[model samples]
Target chain A: MAPYETDDSTRAEDADDLRAGPRRSARYVVPVAVVGVAAATIGLVPALADSGNPDLPKITAQQLIEKIAKSDVQQMSGTVKITTDLGLPNLGGLQNSMASAAPRGGSGSSADPSSKLMELASGTHTVRVATDGQDRQKLSLVESAAEYSLIHDGKDVWGYDSASDQVFHSTAAQDGGKRHDPAPATPKDFADQALKAAGDTTSVTVGGTAQVAGRDAYKLVVKPKQSGSTVGAVTIAVDAKTGMPLKFTLTPASGGAAVVDAGFTKISYARPAASTFRFTPPKGAKVTEEKDGAHGDHRHPKGAGPSSHGLLPGMPGEKGAKGGRKVIGKGWNSIAVLDTGSKGGTPSASGAKGLGGMLGSLGDPVSGKFGKGTVFSTRLINALMMNDGKIYVGAVTKDALVKAADTGH
Target chain B: MSRADPETEGTARTARPAADTGPVTEPAGAGRAPSPLRTLGLLRSELSTTFRRWRTLALLAVLAAVPVLVGIAVRIQTGDGQQSGRGGGGGPAFLTQVTHNGLFLVFTALAATLPFFLPLAVGVVAGDAVAGEANAGTLRYLLVAPAGRTRLLVVKYATTTAFCLVATLVVALSALAVGALLFPLGDLMTISGTRITFADGLGRALLIALAVAVSLTGLAALGLFVSTLTNSGVAAMATTVGLLITVQITDQLPQLHAIQPYLFPHYWLSFADLMRDPVYWDDLVKNLQLQALYAAVFGSAAWARFTTKDVTA
Candidate 1:
């Protein structure tokens, strides 16, 4: 006990002496300073990367639109990152349930180009895109341990899924070169869509100059004039020198964050190697050759079941609605109403029952002048599926969808 | 000092001579920095001591067995002819391809173990690096042996890093061997669906293994920093493992996506990008940069803590 007391007193004295030495304290200060510097650097880097919005020549929105329209700098390759947060419930779990509910050997479930497109509707995805011209382009959706590549070389279009080792091949004449449905939505695609949406219903103005993919660009902000539209604004960063859309962002009216943001992280305008567009089905891969105009049929091998249409199983007003689809309004406030023929008690009415059940779980039941139905709402789009087999879908609020449904009915 | 009295008395018989000898041999230059050659020798000794432990061998054995177990399981599953229509099904990445080409087993096993097992093993080794020496009362002796604190810390870190490489290689080589034995090896189908020769595949596998080892270096430094904060080896190990799991969980949460990129484990799976035909280097570069940041930050922190730390233990 005496020895322990003496040892405790000595340890206290030693600690005091150690603390008293300024040089010893300085030794400790080095690490603390290192940590401080590291923290500062970590915090500083991203801020610095985004710090100075590059100064560039100002251009009007009209000139920018004309420039994008006339820009023909085709031969290029780049990496695009797309992030979409529609405030939907975990779509991964929902996709699993839908896949399970889909029938075995169902074309709508998996291994199809449309199913791959459905994967891009949520979360973040990295896409590698190379375009030699209109007829020769390659887009690869880069997954963690797999890739889904859609290569369009002249007349031949090939879609390859590495994980499944499946190849989907089609000719340009057969599918009108539109079989690249699995390709991720690039900034150019979104920018084109947003530009088309610009009209009397939208106010297009040049916002500011910024840097995107290390290229100075001018921001073209497009805001819908209608109050019912769910979209707050669409901002496209057009490369100042080339007029190429380097970034596209779509924010919701009640946005905390953009619902859809896609931009090139790296870009090169140089012509891609010819080999980039060439694709051959690897050995052991199952190759499916799509016939003329049969892409729709091939995608929905199990007949024209209503649920088997669109990128998702039950998404309304997509392809295959054909003649029954009608636009209820123009521009941003427009709603598409699809007559699914379920109300007439057609033989294929039971086909949508499975999809209806799934939608029932995802959507909330609502009643209006159009009668009882389910309303599925996302951050930027609201879809109201009527009990009478009508689907009202638009980038609008739930009230707008309900109102559109009532008026159309 | 009173603390020195007990330490001297406790190890008095042996420690007195060692303490006296350090000054007697280099009387005028006792405080001078250790030569690089001496530091190299100390590093060699530290590596030998660490690898000689039965626990390290057991951890390595467990890591080696992971690939064997994975390969055998895959072999049995496919042998039953039940593998049809199972492509792209949910499992470890590259797992479904293992049956087609044996080389894929290396990738599958690494992916399966990387998220947890490999890092867990590293955490154990690095967590015990300094604290274990202190717990065994060898830290005071090592320091008094005139092994400067900075030099000892550097050696300890290097040894832990060596363990990381060894553990990762054990898993890779074992996987390669098992993969060769259980399945046919041939042209490898990359993530881009392009075929590369077996040699190229093997080269990529080696690169992937190296990337995985480099990934754990960050965690090793982190564990070493935690070790310097405590004298209890078990406490340090538990704390490191706990931090690893917490960070992993945080990385998974969608709400924390803003900060996930800064976490060590966030980009661990980016090694798979190497399997791409064109080889996407974006995420891989981010991972390497993040790891280097962690190493520099934590390595300096460990050095500082160890240098000024009281050697009461």
Candidate 2:
């Protein structure tokens, strides 16, 4: 009805109303049909892949180590941007990027441990730390957690919470793995749990090349041998030649993209103290006093059944029986994460709580209290021999534990 | 120039029924049919005109784009304990926490739009509601006929409401599209750590959209009120736009935080709280009530103003 529009229409010779017939239907129909067909193909990609082998790779401990030692250095250590998605007491989860982001202290435990606890009178407790030194892990100790130091000159592994100035000590022996502490439980945990677990030569295949940290990096895919959630396939950037891991990436087995990157800064390769490698408690530390007894003296609790191998009711029976002496039984209270094959994760105040929760939920370490501690009990199997094997671990005390290790029964 | 040759018409030959006329029963099929609904019909026509313009179409297209972008953003966010360049740390737990904080985004978007852009778009439609008729010289003819001020006010409100609906839909759809693409679609973990599935997500999105629609009611009523205040389309638009910004600035000041929640647009975003595992219906109900109260008060004022105002322009 605008004057100019009407005038333009009049000047067009008003050609036989091209939109008057069947052509009108065809005009809109053809474009819509073409678009619909194109869209269908784009949605079919995931369905097209063969269900079984998605060309996944396998990883091993040694392989994990070599991948990290790529850039051999004498000294390195720095702040690592760490985020543990499966939320712990103070951890983040799938929505991490969108919400409260907490920075932690990992003197070398995980940021937030699965479980951590301690009794002050005994100064004996367990803890986990972040792979990086960032997270607060204190709940596990009794008295001065003040001596918390993974690189102990002669002390129990512990960390200092500067905010509260509380010194927390770990109960578990500082094994070379991350525990329920933000600080490194041991150098090995930081180097191996992720770097070592993922750092591999044979296990990692070069996917392609890309730039990472402003340096040339190789896109290497590191797949967990048994993929499917609990243990998932991950990818990392490796310095092609030196094999130094530059960045770590994770892609959940269940579909969804957006691989998060955790970059490492300031690292050290200096040899840990001679005392750190040795497991010896400090003087006056009231650790468990082991009684002297022959390995053969220890035995399984009376009336214990084969199904008692510390497995969730539905889980498979111990692979230990086959190896006879194999220590292959599941740790009901010990969620032996295959990801790191280390004890329930880094120990912190709640490290024990975290692993215990996961284990309690996933396995069968039905809750019970032992002493003042919430002791999550499960069958402990004897060391399973790779060659000639026998099974005998659940017994009374340490002598039997050693004898069982040597005698295999 | 025949009968239409009126570049310089004789002193008194016009379309009016001389001096005193009841209603000119113009013949149909003769010309433009007297714009059918008369005053109300003209108001309706005035609103649709904005949608026909390129800027409105462009806004709609932009609205459609939000969903995809949101999806992408959710997908690429960092999940590990730490975040990298240009991104925040993200994870399953964090995602749930953010959902609990849903109302924040709603309030932010509402406040953001009221400032310059959204109100401008609204004014483009509302300002034109009356001044446009005058500009087109349709007002003189309309007043000479049956269109009284009452019918005109109602028609203008209806058209403005329609534009508001379309704009709100644009914002909601865009947010949803982006959220779906960026985040996992199956389940949403809540701040409390409980998991709610997509069924809940979809349901929540709907409530949120409705809440957004509710928020717009205030703006719509404001637009209509402004439209009735002046005959100039641009002036009415500037006035409303200025008021929106002033309110937004005041709402953000820490000193004003205590009373901010009482503002009409304050509770509009509470709809997002619906997506939480234990959906906080309390805030949502409060939001709706507040918005309703705002709409009622503003609508009444607009109604009164338009009904009493002289339309000599």
Candidate 3:
């Protein structure tokens, strides 16, 4: 005890006396109680907050799917953020190969899209989009203040990049006025992709309501029945009032966090002004005119399933696009398998052996019901390269892919 | 003063009073000690004493200057119309847009400092809380005052917490000023991909700053416990900062993923979730709860050690 603590000396004696008895134990009761309550609440809050959706009316999976399929809310404009987290090493050589494989000299694809070869090319990008009906639309990818935008009015399409000071122009033949078909695929057409043929491989369920893009949304969860797939589940948040899809998340089958998340942070149903679709090339900008077939439309045959190509479409004679690719299964669990040897040539100087060795070394080799394959995964997309030349790719789990390979052939 | 009050200890003392024990001039009450008002006075003095030190002032000055330096450097890098390269570095990607909307500077500065500088500053202050006083031989006089050990410990912690708020606010305010000076302030896009009004954006920035401060609570308590372990302020500060860096490195190791969630800095970056539209609350809620868990565990440990600690310099 300090000499100056004259007053505390006496109290210290009392504390000592209390310390020898139940009074000392009493000091701990309050703190212990508080900790207990806190621990209990911590354990309970997330679970409680996760379970209920008071605003959403109960509906069967079939009815909800029907509602989603029939939703016709068009002429909406909003900003969307796309994040892809594929857990793969940064391979500069792979990026170079992918970039050189594109036809238009790597002009207006995406930022280092050569790098986008692996969904493991993890990044978050912002796209601002406006669509009036479908034929007239404009979408811009904003990087800082610079914008890479694509504008299509009727058959004329222009892609402008402010940073590169370049514009790409192409024209598509107009559809016969008498024909009746679904609108041309707009830039923000994820809802259509998510709801497409979901009944095949997915077991649909209604989840709790959430507020997305400042609107009330009901969750529509599509869970894959196949066990081998890496995709745990696909969740879509549909606007309760307008029936428009506002958010889509794909959680990997072996979940840690969402692999791919695409959603509107803000949205408005009101049609964008007519001027939003117009673009005038700035002075001194370089202009490139591309042939009609260069716009990727030639790859999607009429009545054919969605193109099985990666985000960056393969150009003519490009080894990637030349590979014979086939889809196995259907819906969210579907796997796209490609015979990479079909190009009848080895990859750049790296050679098929080097590329194969590199990819194999980068990915984990797993032998399962589907035999041996090397799996490269991120949060969203998983690529399984078999010992043979066949490559299986999907958002499904590893086992699901193996099963698909076993049954797919 | 008579010793009839049950609250006063009944122990006997044999040592004589030490000299130069300033601030003990207040006369002892009859059978009572200092009033609540005087205890509050102790808190005020504690805060002033902590904040007024040259080291503390230097820490705050560095924190305040970080935003200005960042803002100026970004302004120069982007230069009027040149498309800024993708927001470089590990900070939130939106930091690149600071040139377009200065308001983002607040977020940028926070993100820039949270990983090392800010936490380092916090570790320094918290590490010195008790050990510094004891090192300077003032702790004996403080404990000798009517302020009991438990009460004084609480005051020391409260003062450190108050420093947390001041330090965060200084960074934010400096960034706000520098942002307004260097770039346009208007509706800004959020991480959720939605546009929010400038006013609302500012409000969110404030919330983010608060969250950033709160994120350090667990570390603050941890440092308090370390401070109680030694009489040398330097050792306490070093150990606290060593723990922080080690945990940060360990959190990144893939093999340690199972234990990373329990780390204090694991969710420190969760403040980015606030910038999203509809305001993602799950990680934010988890962060607060984790901080609470840390506070409870380490705070109790600090109390248990500090209460019975011998004050000898």
lDDT of each: 0.75, 0.39, 0.65
User: On a 0 to 1 DockQ scale, where is model 1?
Assistant: 0.33
**Which scores greater on DockQ, model 2 or model 3?**
3
Candidate 2 RMSD computed on C-alpha atoms after optimal superposition onto the true structure? 21.2
**What is candidate 2's TM-score against the reference?**
0.37
**Number of the top-ranking candidate, with DockQ as the measure:** 1
lDDT of 1 at A220: 93
- Write candidate 1's Cα lDDT for B3-27 as tens digits: 2231212224223223432333345
The worst-scoring run of ten residues by lDDT in candidate 1 chain A lies at A311-320
Model 3 has a DockQ score of 0.12
Show the lowest summed lDDT stretch of 10 residues, model 2 chain B.
Answer: B15-24
Candidate 2 ranges with C-alpha deviation above 4 Å = A1-409, B1-47, B66-120, B131-147, B175-184, B190-192
**How well is each residue in A1-409 modelled by candidate 1, as lDDT tens digits?**
2232332322432454475576455556655776688789878998989988887776788999999998887788999998877776554664565554442434322445544655666788999988887788888899877888878887887777777666777676555554444333689877865776666878999999899998999999999888888888889999998989999988889978998899999999999877667676655556776545645443432322232233122212232243445667766777766667545232123334445665578888999877999987777767777887777767778998888877765
For candidate 3, lDDT tens digit of each residue in B53-74? Answer: 9999999999999999999887
Weakest ten-residue segment in model 1 chain B by summed lDDT: B1-10
Clashes of each: 0, 117, 22
